[model samples]
Target: LEGLAGELGIADRVSWLGFRRDVPELLAAADLFALASEEEAFPTALLEAMAARRPLIATRVGGVEEIVTPGTGRLVAAGDVEGLVAALSALVSDPESARRQAAAARARVEREFSTAAWLGRLDALYLDALGQRAQAPRVAAGERPA
Candidate 1:
């Protein structure tokens, strides 16, 4: 990150805090959250940003598309710098629209990714797995199960 900052001639423009315990507070103080991962699986940072009610700009990769809808945030193709720039520009140019989108993102997170919702989904998945195992035909010792 330091190298990149120097290369971009914006060393003064960036502050790289290695690890932070106050992530929620930091997120809440931000105007926007941008995630440019090339690939990701259910990113908790994205969810945190959503929960923080910040407008988001994320690359369309992995579960990001499923989480960031049109009304909630902007989605750009992975590795598309121009698209990312446009997304940021749009949000910066339209504060009211950005706020509206931020609100929707927060609502979506609260409605679908809340602790109760996650726990309920996990319980359902475990139940389904157990049910499937129970329905499997019993096999004799030393015999292969079909």
Candidate 2:
């Protein structure tokens, strides 16, 4: 990352804070949050950004689309530099829209990704799995469980 920053002539503009414990504080202080991952699976960083009510710009890969909806954030195709640039530029130019999106992002996180929501979903999944197990036909005593 430092090498890339130097190549892009942004070394002075960027700070490389490796593995800090104050992630929430950092996100809270940001005007926007961007995740340029080529691939991801429901990244926790994205959720943390949403929880912090920061406007989000993320790649449309894996479960990202499920989190970053139209009013919540901007999603670009993975590796699409132009799309990412456009999203960031738009947010920078329109603070009202950005703030609205940030609020929406935070609301979505609270609605769908909160601790209570997660626990409820987990409990439901466990119950459904247990019910399915009970409904499955029993194998003979000498057979392996299937």
Question: Top model by lDDT, which number?
Answer: 2
| Deviation from native of the Cα of residue 6 in model 1, angstroms | 0.4
lDDT for position 97 in model 2:
98
Q: Per-prediction RMSD in angstroms? A: 3.0, 3.0
The parts of candidate 2 lying over 4 Å away from their true place are: 126-146
lDDT of 1: 0.93
List model 1 lDDT by residue over 1-146, tens digit each. Answer: 79999999999999898899999999978989999999998898998999999999999999988899879999999989999999999999999999999999999998899998899999999999999999999899999977
Q: Estimate each model's TM-score.
A: 0.82, 0.83
Clashing pairs in 2: none
Q: What is the lDDT of residue 109 in candidate 2?
A: 93
Report, for every candidate in turn, its global Cα lDDT versus the true structure: 0.93, 0.94
